[model samples]
Target: MRRTSLHDCPAPAKLNLFLHVNGRRADGYHLLQTVFQMVDHGDLLHFDLRADERIVRTTDVPGVPEQGDLIVRALLLLQAAYARRHGHPPQGIDVAIDKRLPMGGGLGGGSSDAATALMAANALWEAGFSREELMALALPLGADIPFFIFGQTAFAEGVGEALLPVEAPDCWYVVIEPGVAVPTAAIFCSEHLTRDTKPVRITDFSRHTMNRTDSTGFGKNDLQAVAVSLFPPVAQAIDWLSAHGDARMTGSGACVFCAFSSEAEADTVLQQVPGIWRAWKAKALMHHPLNTVLQVSAVIE
Candidate 1:
């Protein structure tokens, strides 16, 4: 095995506070309003720097194309952007991703993976790309990619690209995955999907929000109904979870999460869930773990 410099990074999952399809754009993107909170549950990526200007993945991700890997694309985008800015290309690095998050679960795993690559490559290659510049590059990869680069709780809108940082309540999440893949594009393109929601203000969020206790005000995913209709397993998972606690789909479908005020509460629910379904008890993270790693790297420089 060729030894390489260690650049370990995290790829965290995101939960949708609420998803509203306000409308669709002429370009075919759905306009949306939602809050994105990072969770501790996600994949871990370990990067190794190489002298050659070639990008490679040491690990294979099931269901995702190797040639179209977002991590490689992110690194290439960073390399190109830096080369253009400084008038010189930098050395390349090989990435090894430990993909724990399930594909097509609407957990923002792919986007987070891409963000980790961008951040880690920036450090290893000595490319001084600002968060704003990285975010600009991330948007073309995926709308949720930018939020992971920003790496905080945020109010998201405009096809989930526009972001406004916000402070969210601390809570634990009981996330359940049904071992099924939900296609995001199919949900967005469904004719039955709700797309005429009135625009909401941030203040409106407070009025319609739910507590860990009430569970009533926690908003709905406008795409949930459409997703459930398409994927019955998603509805089954949500129904099973809702029986134990307040359950809602995180993004579009396939994964549903319930909120708990305490770890005990979350664990209790986790215990009762059937083993056939993949589940985890994780707390909402105020900051991404990679953020701390980036900070320490900055100090070393």
Candidate 2:
């Protein structure tokens, strides 16, 4: 039997346990080193195959046009990549995103959605592309997309494409979403941004086991200060959450998170979050939930 759809595919969000800016490239892109930790809370996607080579998005995502949506772009990219290799385009797909994660909250929502679309499209189209191929194909779309395709908690470098799987502590996180969108480009281009933070070796981070009792936390996010200064809501959220523990802004800004030893500890804080902001508790996921299904997809007819 031919499978025509892949429903309820998860596109889990990620937290930058710590983000450091190493330097700037000749291309003006900032070099970075970050540990991306996958959290269980994120968006979901559904893919339905089409008979013709007409890519479409079945659902409307607020603020994201159909053509500009990363999910649609990912499908187009994959289709072009496949056509270049196989001399023929695969069938089109209709992707519906169950958008849950906050936009521009440093949660990697869009990039994660793009990665899931690529993975699910490979399976439904039976493109037979390997994980490495998919990662490479996904890189041009966004730096964070490859990390999601890597399907593990990873230590990432070089514009966040180079990846090495690392062990992340099994813990829970209480994330607070400040009602603001922190633009990534704006944060990176700011004169006050820290471009050189004295890069640390992987061993430096691997030595620290994150838990409730560990007082000496890992490296701090270098972009936090800039984001905090630019967004007052971010600063307020962090100031409040820090009372519970060491809370820091995730990637660029607008979301702050604190790690706890148990779900109960996280929930206690989640319940106390102010009504003005959105909050949730999620367990740390060492690997992606859909990792098992991301094998070499075989063509089905």
Candidate 3:
């Protein structure tokens, strides 16, 4: 029988080990240099085939309309592309998402969800697009979407589209959600935002250990200053975690994290987090979970 559904498909969240805004293009898109670090923990997606040609999401993500959810948008994009490629409309799919990550937390949770949905839909429908093709489709959805499609610890640039795989150390992290939603546009459009930090080579990051001993493991995230200034909770969370290690904001604002050498150590810190904020112990993932699923189908590795 043909494969009808893919179960337990993981959409892993990503952390920016360091984000630098190098400059802006004439198009007003910022040039960025950062490492996309995948954490093992994130939202999960399950797909079951539908008879007609209408994609639907069964789960309701708070503060997001189903019509505007990135995953839904991605599915529509994929169906359009698939129809053009195959000369027939693809089958509809029901998407059930088990969301473990927070929205607007700078964690790449939404982008990761879109990427995971795209991969699962591609296989179930036999759309036959390569990873390269899928990344092209995903990029317009979100700049961060392509990196999740790339499915590896990667170095990203060019508004976060340019991705080249890099080896980040296997480590544990204490991620603080801070219970606040920071708007990406506010941070990007901030008058105080720095738009010209010198770019660092990927090798510079690869050479250092992410563990506690390295004071300057990677360059600082340039977004942190703008984020902290706008969102007090972000600053509070960072300050709260800084007492333990080098805590930094992962993406634009709100969520912050620090690396630890072991799960026990990470868990120890997790327990000490303040009562108001939510925190978790997450391990760095070497690759996207869908990478393994794709390999099993012998589609892409």
By TM-score, the better pick of 1 and 3 is 3
Instruction: Provide the lDDT at 228 for model 2.
Output: 90
lDDT of each: 0.82, 0.88, 0.87
Question: What would the per-residue lDDT of candidate 1 be over residues 1-301, giving only the tens digit for each residue?
Answer: 5335555578999989788989889998889999898999888888877778788888877767767988888888888898898898877777787778988898999989999888878777767778878889989989999988887888889988888776666888899998889988898888898899888876667555534332234567898999889898888899998887678998887799988878899999999999889999888887778878767321100
In candidate 1, which residue pairs get closer than 3 Å at backbone N, Cα or C atoms, i.e. clash? none
Clashing pairs in 3: none
TM-score, cand. 2 vs. native: 0.95
The order of the candidates by lDDT, greatest first, is 2, 3, 1
For candidate 1, the C-alpha RMSD (Å) to the true structure equals 3.5
Tell me the deviation in Å of residue 8 in model 1.
3.3
Residue 54 alpha-carbon offset, candidate 1, angstroms: 0.6
